[model samples]
Target: MPENTERDWVLPTEIPFSELKGKDLEECVYWLLDAMGAKDLEWRIGGAGGGAADGGRDLEAHFFEPDEEGELRPQRWWVECKGRSGTVESQEVKEACNNALAYEGIDRLIIATNTQFSNPTRDWVKEWQRTFSRPRVQLWDRAHLERYLSRHP
Candidate 1:
């Protein structure tokens, strides 16, 4: 065995969030969701899925939660992974939320970012949620992702 082999992959805490972006970031979120029991995970292509989505590179998965009748129903989840060097913007988050909400049968929309969201952006999400609620919104930022990494590591 090589004595000088680096274990960077095993020590993800040393890796900065900026190191992950685009498809690389999305894939990480995809695997995390898989580990957390999200079912039928697929890369979203096109806005409607099957091709490039309006959100560009994103993911789709399902979480089975108890319905009103106590039956577990599959709730579709659209995950928008943003690995940005800068803070995640308001308009971009709005667009992603609106797009997912408009899309039929999308039970939840999670905007996962490797960077912190702008204050206004977070506020806007809160306002949007107060007015329009159906597709639940979750913002998983750098801290969240880091926690996930620590748990899974």
Candidate 2:
């Protein structure tokens, strides 16, 4: 079992969508992102009330590398947050992966969903892991979520 922190790994039963908008989702995502040790990160929580454009990615974090401009440029780290009760479908995962591929200089794509991915989606992830050498896209389901939350909270 994953460790429990000040804030436990909440299911949809604990916190519904009505509660997880804006600051609530942002706080959760921030904890996970920090636990992941993401540097130079920027996040937008719960692609609702407007910010769902530029693909379905919830957070657009750019890990910077020194460029010729002598300034840190955004590297690809398009994060899609699915804080839903239902298991994520394969099509959504595919769409996020495709978006990551389309973005310039994205080193990786992270799909962070509160629920598990469908079996087909898990298989698809395995295939992508084998196929993609650079700019790989990976899935992080509720287990990962709980682990991170446990560490932080």
Best by TM-score: 1
Candidate number of the best lDDT: 1
- Compose the digit string of candidate 2's lDDT tens values, residues 1-153: 978768545553453443453455556776667666667667654445655554656666656567898997656676777666578777878877766766667777787776678888888878887777657777877677666666655
Candidate 2 ranges beyond 4 A from true positions: 1-23, 45-51, 54-56, 62-76
How do the residues 35-98 of candidate 1 rate in per-residue lDDT, one tens digit apiece?
8888888976444423454453288889999999999999989888877898987877988888
* Residue pairs whose backbone atoms clash in candidate 2: 5-153, 6-153, 76-106
**Superposed Cα deviation of residue 133, candidate 1 (Å):** 1.1
| Candidate 1 structure, TM-score to reference | 0.82
